[model samples]
Target chain A: MRNILILLSFMFILLSCSKEEKEDLPKDPIILPPYNPTYVDLNDRLPSYLPRMDIPADNKTTIEGIELGRALFYEPLLSGDGTQSCGSCHNQSYGFTDNGKKFSTGIDQVEGNRNSMQIINAGLRTSFFWDGRAATLEDQAFGPVTNPIEMHEKWPRAVAKINDISTYREMGYKAFGVVQLDSVLISKAIAQFERSIISGNSKYDRWKKGEYQMTPQEDYGRKLFNKDRDEIRDSLGNVIQVIPGADCFHCHGDLSDFTDNLFHNNGMDEIFTDPGREKVTGNAYDRGKFKVPTLRNIEHTAPYMHDGRFKTLDEVIDHYSDGLVHSATIDPLMKNVDIGGVRLSLSEKAALKAFLLTLSDPDFLDNPDYSEPPPL
Target chain B: MNMNTVSKITAILMLVTSLALTSCSKEEEMGCWPPLDVPGDSANVIMIFNATTNGQPLELLKNFKDPLGRTMQVELLKFYVSNVFVSFNGASTLLKKAALVILVDPNVTDTTKKHNEIALKIPYGNYDRITFSVGLDVVQNAGDPTKYPSAHPLSINQNTYWDAWGKYKFFMIEGKGDWDGDGTLTNIYGYHTGFDECYRSISFEKMLTLDATNSNETLNVNFEVNDVFFGKDTLDMKLHPSWHGDINTIETAFIISDNFQEGLRLN
Candidate 1:
């Protein structure tokens, strides 16, 4: 009888202790290992001539992040319809530019207004989009996904879809230390991958280092392109002054405007239907002004201009040669505005075209690092 | 205690420790991040720059025969408003006193363009007057285009910062007019003003009271495009076809600069 009493007493005491322990314990008791992402130095990835790019401090680039970003960029799951990814418009072989199309067709089969910008040297750019509408790569990333004419996916739905995928969720955890994927982190990863897309090692870059020799035509063309304004008179009885050179350098940059990553009206139209920079600033002076693309890999990035109006390099050169449009906001750099164009001789135009071809970076177009990743 | 009882107690303690550690680890991941939800001061004043011809909203790229009887279409109209100081009963309090630069572009039809509305965060109080500069101040105006980050309002992409002259255009009003009244825009008149001499500051005695109770207050500010041209001192378009950041343009640029005060009306 005493033994049975002892057993009952022990059981009662154990039950009371367990009840107290339940109240004392926390709501969740799963010890997940702390995620400390590995950071990679971005400066190490870029050439010395180019300054280290400005990325958001919050979204620092990491090895895992870049890999996940590559996967997400190639993943069609993020699209509203499963037919497109960032890789759809941005092809790897064409210097990350869409192939010869003026306007890239969106997932909805509707055409976008402007040309799809090449990702080459994008990390070095101060603004994204030809209009300079978005200030950061991350800001630029959010634009295509939700744009009704583009991917057409609502960000929340996209996030929910991303959360449903175990592969992406694992990537998200490894990259951002978050189990639930957020738009901000996804954008950061994509931007980091994009920043890794660098295009140097062009014929022009090698020419600077004396690794390659240009043909006489290419050399003359380069000289003509670098031509600054010279005070001269032509036979039209109109004295043209103020605009000089082949007059390309001022608008283009030191390597000409392409490398400069600046914007200009470039005298494309007298009255602009599409106000390029003006659309972003609402300034009428910015009407018809579009960001000057780098001349690097220009051969691959044809149909040119913000609208992709010019089909070939010759068309672009011809426009600069004589198709200049006088406008209220036409850049004053075209010093010979009275006569309309630079009046390049036929041979000069051909040479300029030859020089432009030298800017194509084959290695950039073929690099496996920038190629589409395996299916996510 | 028996081995079985000891094992049960050990497991309970382990669970409690694990829960505490999990909680700590989650917080540890987020502890370094800047707080996401700190609110900003209310922006009380919403200034809208509207272009109107005789009380009708000015339509861009249209041939408008203004009250001055010149048949012209405003091809472009853009400027900067900066260094604004609010004037109260006796003293003046500067808003964004150091770095307040706002680019005003009234054209909104373009999908790519930024909207013209400016949301200003004025301090909590009452003010009967306001004062501001017509363009970017000297320091912000005169900088290497590459020196500043792209995100800055002053930093630009080659167009605003002219590479030829290496000068920034403060304000621009470009248009074509039929000076002969022949129904054709033969005369291309533009007043692209810049340089330190052209920067003007104007003040208006308009009653405004900003308090805690009132938020999202809007102020209707009219920018008469005509005031920029035809006033007491007028812009003689014939003498000046265009004045874009040239040393010789200082004389013509000042005439347009002085006219800004007359055009700005606080309704």
Candidate 2:
């Protein structure tokens, strides 16, 4: 009986010790305030799934990397003629797309094949360019720099120019651990800065987060956006399901980043014969297809289409409503749908346009970080 | 019974406790449940493609028949097959690792480096049924290329047809076809299909049981190219059917039929 009492006392002591250890475990650290230049407490407000910007294993992002990238992005020395920077085509005031032309002119007044894609919320994009050619923002950065029509500078020369600057040299070394530059390191730094150009503070975003209410017309437009159109038939006279009508979601579907990242021949103009995608594949069937651009800031990034054929959102809507041209390669979903040729009522068009305008993010346009580097 | 006897008993108890603690310390130093030196086994399967017609080895790009039975020269031949899932008694394994590889001049009979194409390492396991598709997944095909390297073949310039569209050529089947009067010159025609609609899924139960033991093994898979074209209903490429570009019509028929299954010969 005395031994049993001793054993029970020892067990009780061990249990108490375990309980104390459990209580002593530390809790997770609380995130501090002043999330950025502003004193906004954003720890609780940020979305959990916001894509973590990819930093190359080789060149990681740092304060110096962002600063150097911003300077290079704004500097004209990146161009072959030393006249245009990436900022020339992607101006902050115009939603990161040039407002002056249908197709932005590059070096020597050479015209690009496609309209300038808007860079608003581009950080969230899974692929860059209408063709989805470049896989990363870094890869896309090298295109305009090297394209004969664009900045027109070879990668080696571009890297050499950046290496010449001591500030950039030091910044590159500090950020990527090398004063000498390469395409990979250059692209990484530029991509890091580009990823920082996030734009989610739109009224639509507010509505999604349940922070704001939509107007009655805007509500109706949203309903139409989700509803399917009437059944349509293809050029071959095959019946096609048209459940979701003028739903932009059919193409530019994702709520946050509007592009679906799929290529389609949306029956813009049948006779143009540009052979948009076919040129890439050499297949007779792939002709006339082009990637659907994002609709996040579609209101500002007009004239639309690969060639900037449509001047206004109304024209684009009209094209979708009643302007569809029958072709062998037209998307099956786009077959004889009453849309692309059907005329929407003026008031309905106005409401739809209003709904599109809600997508414009004021914070992105005014973000100080996205602006030109403050004088040195 | 005296104080000296009590001191000796105390020393024995202390020694026992010290030995128990030392054993435990050694165990801690050895660390976690499983020891570091334990050996684990895995399987690796290599797929080999050889193109042959009848008993003779047929050149993929060079030989083609025209209406008058005339020979035609060809240049390139490539195609895409994705969503490859291997099953052992109806369980899926890592299949996305299978992707497109270009076979330039598949018809060349020279036992040189041209004929050999192999996919990289797949974790070793017993797979009785191996199934693969002729096209990409809808989500994967449509998803932005910026996220992953595998999504965009053009980014690496793996696909030759990278200019007309930014998309990776899902499939490139190029060869010489019979022309009206164009003589012995190589006439290149390619069948490259991609986009969400073009996505095709093919699942087949591999009859051969794969045994992954100590060493890696290669599963020699022989595909008769003609089988893909000659189905229960022979699809004559010369007819130039309107449904060639129509993915919906072709993908449904191709995925369900035994045409793709019969074409696969595993040794």
Among these predicted structures, which one has the highest TM-score?
Answer: 1
Instruction: Return the DockQ of model 2.
Output: 0.02
User: What would the per-residue lDDT of candidate 2 be over residues B1-267, giving only the tens digit for each residue?
Assistant: 999999999999999999988755331334211111212443444556555544345553436444345454334445555555667777766434335544553212235443335442444555677666655565445433333342233222133222213334455444444444555332223344555444545554564443454335555656555554464445444332112233334442343234544665666
lDDT of 1 by residue, B131-150 (tens): 87876678656655554444
True contacts kept of 2: 0.00
- Alpha-carbon runs more than 4 Å astray in model 1: A1-34, A233-244, A254-259, B1-267
After superposition, candidate 2 runs with Cα above 4 Å error:
A1-46, A49-55, A153-164, A180-184, A232-244, A337-348, B1-267
Cα deviation at A60, candidate 2, in Å, is 3.2
- What is the clash tally of candidate 1? 14
| Overall lDDT per candidate, in order of appearance | 0.68, 0.57
lDDT of 2 by residue, A243-352 (tens): 33354554564434555456676777656458876665565555677777767666667788888888888888777777887554555445333235434567666677
Q: What local lDDT does model 2 show for residue A178?
A: 46
**What lDDT is reached at residue A154 by model 2?**
74
Q: Give a tens-digit lDDT track for model 1, residues A1-376.
A: 9976885585445335431222222222222244777898776766544434666788888888988888878777778997788888888877677878889998889998889888877777778899888889988887787888778887777776766666776677678765555677788888989988877788877776678999999998877776643432354534455432365654454322254565666777877889888878877767788877777788998888888899988999888888887776665455345466777879988998888898888888898887887766
